[model samples]
Target: MTFAFDNAPVWLDLLGVFFFAVSGSLLAARKHIDIVGSLLLASLVGLGGGVIRDIILNTGPPAAFTTPAYLVPPVLATALVYFLFPYVQRYTSMLTLFDAGGLALFCMTGTIKALASGMNPVASVLLGVTTAVGGGLLRDVTANEVPELFNPKSIYAVPAFVGSAMTSALWVFGLFNVLTAAVVAAVVFAFRVLAWRRSWQAPLAVNGWQRRSSDPKP
Candidate 1:
């Protein structure tokens, strides 16, 4: 219930940064961008969401700017992918898996950070989801595509919302801790992987234009 993160795993945050960087770098590789573009995308995807969350919390500078550790993994990941572009592209499934891992990790950490910063539960939940998906949104937009979070054919944001809500609820009930955070993250990650494998989709309304075109002339 208290927002103390004294026992939070440092590795959790590192994993988040690394996997997100991988996903971003892979996207750049797919686009056939040079190493500079790869590194730029890696930085954005690895830190964009956290930057947004920090700005919202008025945390200033963001951890990526303030912490050398936060900056290293993305840069390393970009170089790794840049050099191994063919192998990475050949195994695209890793991208999806890494992205799912990053999403779950970010949601929990983001929520914890917001709550620790004295944010209200509602704001914390929204920020948690933002932290989970914001980086990918930037990556997609930069790639000139609609964000996966907004796609009706994807379950990306739904799982993030669920994870964030679960963490908040646990915190409210005085049951939150590092273990709970890990469990919640795992659950979110599993849901995402399952949804991807099963092709699960959010419901979408038929466009009025499509309906109008199919109707008889009046």
Candidate 2:
């Protein structure tokens, strides 16, 4: 496949896809899935978000389907994971780490795409968050696992929101370039990693009722 992207945003999109594919394949390893299943999971998580974004944006064709280059990453990720499953299974945290990297890149790229398609800032931010989390949601659901998005103990979407918001502002101000995008991704990725390591989480149902880390498991 031809390895090409029209712009830096598309490059970010592809890198994000690759990261998400790795995360999906890692989950397949955890579930003891076969190689084919690993490939399918990787494709699902890698392309699912971009497809959802394009569909919502009413783009003629999703970038995942239109660009042959976009298809290569998932395949490569699956192959890598398939060959490294033994060692991969030992580091369970890698699954989320890859997902966090994807989340960071996708939020910025997704928001940029939405805005480029004439979406309002609010809608772009919403679409950005969707593009970051949709694939993981699909991956978990298909694997019979709870989605991080719905997990009260996870701070998944907040980091996406922050990055998307930053991207949107930068785009509107004409300051969105590779350097700024990198800064946004770094901030989001670091925030996500710290949240995971520190066990930081969003609030629960009620006004102030949340299970603290010190709370005993039921």
Candidate 3:
């Protein structure tokens, strides 16, 4: 299937890039990093996942580096956030919303990119999850903290999985066109936001030792 360039997807991609960049910059500011450090972190958080996804898909150097639209947004977002730190700091929840939007957009975009590169549905879904969460994983690791996606307390990876699965399902149903992408993106974003609001999480199994204490021996 040919994925044509459309205004909706383009805007969605740019918005995702901008907000993820903002989230990274905000983290840097909280760490008391300099402007340069903030920009570096923001750009990495904005583009790192897409870079990894491209490499894994055997695509050339990342679009963020090759295309001005991809490169410029992160830089601009970082700068804007740096200058608007006070205002942003006052409403941290708004930043969370942006991050969720980024997650959804990236998940959808990554799935489409993988499909475009001739990957199967399963691989495409995995690629989508990777692209959605990879940058944040990189950011946390660089900052010397446990990545949120791996931590039990964080609800990060679940949203990516849901979004990716939805995208893949839509694609499999022959709805892999632009309109479907938009719908999937919106659905993904809505799910993430609702999950965040309600603190919805996946169930974890009790460890063997813990389970033994609660059960009687046969």
Each candidate: how many clashes? 0, 0, 0
lDDT of 1 at 40: 90
Each candidate: RMSD: 4.6, 3.7, 4.8
Comparing 1 and 2 on lDDT, the stronger one? 2
- Leading candidate by TM-score: 2
| Tens-digit lDDT track of model 2 for 54-118 | 99999798988788999998999999988887876777689988999999999988898898889
Instruction: Give per-residue CA lDDT, model 3, range 26-70, as digits (tens).
Output: 888878888888888888888888888878987788777777898
Q: What overall lDDT goes with each candidate model?
A: 0.83, 0.89, 0.77
Model 3: residues >4 Å from true position, as ranges?
Answer: 1-11, 205-218
State in Å the error of residue 21, model 3. 0.6
TM-score of 1: 0.87
Stretches of candidate 2 off by over 4 Å are 1-6, 208-218
Candidate 2 similarity to native, TM-score: 0.92
lDDT-based ranking: 2, 1, 3
* Candidate 1 per-residue C-alpha lDDT over 131-205 given as tens digits, one digit per residue, 9 for 90 to 100: 999999998899777788886556899889999999888887888876788799899999998887777866557
lDDT computed for candidate 3: 0.77
